[model samples]
Target: MISPRAPRADRRPVVRSHHGRSFTDDYEWLRDKSSPDVVAHLEAENEWTAHETSHLAPLADAIFDEIKSRTLETDLSVPVRKGDHWYFTRTVEGSSYGVFCRAPVASPDDWVPPAVDPAQTLPGEEVLLDANVEAEGHDFFSLGTFDVSPDGRSLLWGVDTEGDERYTLRIVDLASRAVSDVDVIPNTAAGAMFSPDGAFVFYCTVDDAWRPDTVWRHAVGSSSGADVTVFTEPDDRFWVGVGRTRSRKYIVVEVGSKITSEVHLLDAADPMGEFAVVWPRVEGVEYDVEHVVLAGEDRLLITHNDGAENFEVVDVAAADPRGLRDVVVPASTDTRIDGVDAFAGHVVVSYRRDALTRVGILPLSGGIAAGGVLRVGEIVGYGALTELEFDEPLFDVGVSSNPEWTQPTLRLGFTSFVTPSTVLSVDVATRETTVLKRMPVLGGYRSEDYAQARDWATAADGTRVPISLVWKPGAVDESAPAPTLLYGYGSYEASMDPSFSIARLSLLDRGILFAIAHVRGGGELGRHWYDDGKTLTKRNTFTDFVAVGEHLVASGRSRPDGLVAEGRSAGGLLVGAAVNLAPDLFAGVLAGVPFVDALTSILDPELPLTVIEWDEWGDPLHDPAVYDYMSSYSPYENVRSDVGYPPILAVTSLNDTRVLYVEPAKWVAKLREVGAPALLKIEMQAGHGGVSGRYDAWRERAFEYAWVIDTATRGARDDLESSAPVAPTLDA
Candidate 1:
């Protein structure tokens, strides 16, 4: 069979000048996505990609089937009690989306959620929203906000049909099951919630750059033109978000940048009232607010990084937020206190320690009961804080789904590399844990067959970076290095924790290993880790990933010729830079929606979310030093033709606003210029996240994984030939 010719983009060189420096961009024409020529080029690229990987169709199907078979197709999520109803979602065997439903509460004292059966609906079950039905006739559909009103009579929901991050919010009357014509809001951001009385809906709107910069409040029965602007952030660096406190006592509006934040609160009873600032904005200090009652008085719990690298909790009077305060949970160097969720009986503290997410419960003194009455044996001070311990040495656990302020049980979610997602309910008074639901794995999976472990890599600057390793116990070892996929993402202080993936089973079952490189830009160790890997120190993120790949190969856990590097989004940037730093360390590279053209993106403030990103990456437009530094390690700028680079696959969506499609398109074009066998797949109907439906997403992952597997075993499979006939060319 003859190999198809690669699609070559025409060179339309455009000179870009910044900080007394000039650069020529050959593929800048791709930036104009609306141009017919650009669309044709993208379509040609997709056609070439499909033709190149057509041999992996059978493997891709097998992998997708494995993922579907291992998953319980028809299942119901554990019901969660909120207000007067127990709400849950169900997924039918053939459906692409979930159906949200709720059942009436049995009694006022009924706190235990009703058991839901996948085969049948519970008694008195009311369907709130059927996403599958709503998604009909649309190629891409995303449900943004699914907030039910406090009275349970009204529902506020939002949907994005175009995958552009802008949503259309609408209210539906539960009794009549009719969408309100008067309350239709278009071009809204992702989150929106109904006011405490369910008469008002608070939502956010994005600016031209796609940043949520304004918060608005709309009357339930009013038109969009009559919606009042609650608050707006003039600074492009800050984004605004609106939500109510878990206690349902105050409406909260938060304005935050990458490094700083300020919160505003208003009495929930007043729909047209002024919101008071909890604390004035401070540079480099980030804090989150949670309403709680202590000593029979209203107080706000603040988890802040003010003068503390790792956050600390402070208790202050809610009536006078900036007044005198008491340090409830003091700052610690060994732990990072992320945030706090307050309830009537207790406060759940989410923190990170020993490179793992952990949760602790702190009972409030003089706590109020669900009936709005004070407990009889309440005290003034707080009870001892105790951690919700788990036996897993490496796992990710956090508080989840306990929306009620006076609920007795705290819902927590726990998962690890081998453990399926498990939801648990912990009694606030007795510290007793009850497993509410453990996601079923239909393909007879055993945890004992797989193993998870931690490893450390020494960076060039003597910094120790952590690496999370997972594989089949008997299949992967140092004595016989297996085909390995090393993943990394080190940006925005996001910590990539270990979680079980049914799709990953296809790899491990085939004697392949998977690993995560917790590099410096991530919050795995603490804020300090992220601090050392951003702005001027951004090169540390790339060097750290290269070090992990070197460590894996040197330690005999992976062969130099069988290692595949993979990352998505910011992590995609990681592998991109790593390959430039050390081209021979891996056999293949997979970058999904990668920020490869970092310098180019950051230099332009008009791009989507670019102004808000100045804190994560320095202000390259204004700072000459930053521009110079970023130019040194930016993946696109540093692509070298001299090195024997590995085979590369870049996956991006046409409508992705975060990192525009042109970044990868330009990067792949440059790679082809160097004679590298690079494939670019563009999803014309998707956003930053490739496909919407689960099955479509699974197929996308399978295609990428098949490429990884084929590249990793290229040495052994070189003799195999494709018996299949050539496919027809795609129309441009």
Candidate 2:
């Protein structure tokens, strides 16, 4: 079928210069998203993409339906015991969102989550918030934070109606089931917390640039205009957040940037009190605090990177905040400390060791309900930490839902690429773990049918990069080639941990081998892994991804002819940069909300998050070195007419504040002008994350995966076409 002729974006050149380096952007005119011509061009591009992918509609639909069929439409989460209630969320059939509910606890000390199912509602079930009911008239919906008061009498929730990050804070009387008539606080950020007595709540608000710069304390039922500004960070580079410690004894006001952080503590018992800094902000120090009672002393479980890039845990007295004696010294270059959680009897240490997530339990001795320490040395007081063991070599596991400090069991979540997410309850004292539930996959499914493994590719600098792989047992043949999709994201020190995806099953069954490149710039291996991939070393991120794509071919895992590269947001930048560096290495490139115009965006400090991102991308505007370094790799500026670029799909949203839609819109326009097979699909009503709602999300994945399969297959039509799973009949 002949694809529709795409609309041509008029060349309206805009000269942009930074540190004596200048470039002309012909598609810069497309940045005016509000203009009718801009909308028409995007709409026309959507039409052309639809025409090009018309034959894959059945394929997309089949995958979407498969996801829906495999997923349990109605399900209930494990109830978490908080005060006198067991709080949980349930999803119903035909519901776009979840319903937050709670059931009365048999006893306050009962830590086990109720054996409840959405199909059979438990007695005395009280619904606190029905997101479906609340999201009745909105194009986008997100629950930034939802928390219950200390007495469990009221609920404070934050909601974002649009794709924008700002949320509206609301209060509801749990007993009366009536929304409070008080004026709601709008434009609040994440990490909102209630005071111990439940009279007041502290939340953060963004400045003009959409940075969460100011934190405020507001009386629950009072007008938002009467709220008091508790703290404000004058620096545009730092973002602020407020939250109560896990112990519920201290309220923390955290302010930090990419490289530095400072935390202030307030006694939760005192609502109108001043906060004291635990440690003065050091130039390059980043630390997180958690209140804990150790050996009869009030202390903060501090995880800081004083000199250790991977960070180490130290116990500092709450009274003598400046005293930082080490409890657990940093591991030599292996384990990267992610975070810590404090409980009455123990501290849960979360870190990444050996490139996979690891969780350990550090037990406290001689601790009581009230505070008092025996005055032992920091290192000798706490017993040796015990590591939680998981059989799978590659899996994502972490702690959560541990509301009560005195609770005996720790709630954990675990999932691997081929394993359905399982909720586990661990007995703190016994070290025994009990699997509460494995998410139900409705359609007939078996984990044994799938396979997952890890491989490594050596970089140009001799650094080995790990690649996580997943596929059906017979999905690929080493003797021949198979359609492959390589995904990577190497910015912000984020690790793309292995997790199960029902939608991914469709691709695996369709003769596709999916892999994730644990490239540099990510904290997978350690902090240095990320350090070597950002700013001046940013090229390592792109090159590492290309190296993995090349390794996958050389290792007989997959061939270059049928390889596709995929990434979203920062990952989009990864995929985009890789294509520019080696266009012929990939059969197609799927970039979602890509930061392709890295140099252009970094030069403008006024854009949302632009200034705050300097730590990650470097100061390109003022630093001539950074400017030249970034200009050499910025995807948009590097698009050349001479190269035979791959078929590219650039997906973006109009309302996104993080990575502007204009980046991909302009990237695709330039690619098309250069005679490359490229298309742009815009989600007009969505934000940074595409369309909300599980159904919409499923359909979106289906659209992208269908395209990935089609394009990857196009490169080697006869490689595995005979073995590919056929689209299911509509009636099936």
The TM-score values for the models, in the order shown, are: 0.96, 0.95
**Candidate 2 clashes between residue pairs 3 or more apart in a chain or in different chains:** 295-373, 296-372, 296-373, 297-373
Taken over the whole model, the C-alpha lDDT of each candidate is 0.89, 0.87
Which run of 10 residues does model 2 get worst, by summed lDDT? Answer: 368-377
lDDT computed for candidate 1: 0.89
Candidate 2 lDDT (Cα, whole model)?
0.87
lDDT of 2 by residue, 54-110 (tens): 999999999999999999999988888888888888999899899999898887567
Cα lDDT tens digits, model 1, 370-429, are 221111122355655677788987899998898787888999999999999999999888
Model 1 RMSD in angstroms: 5.6
What are the runs in model 2 whose C-alpha is more than 4 Å off?
Answer: 1-4, 366-380, 718-732
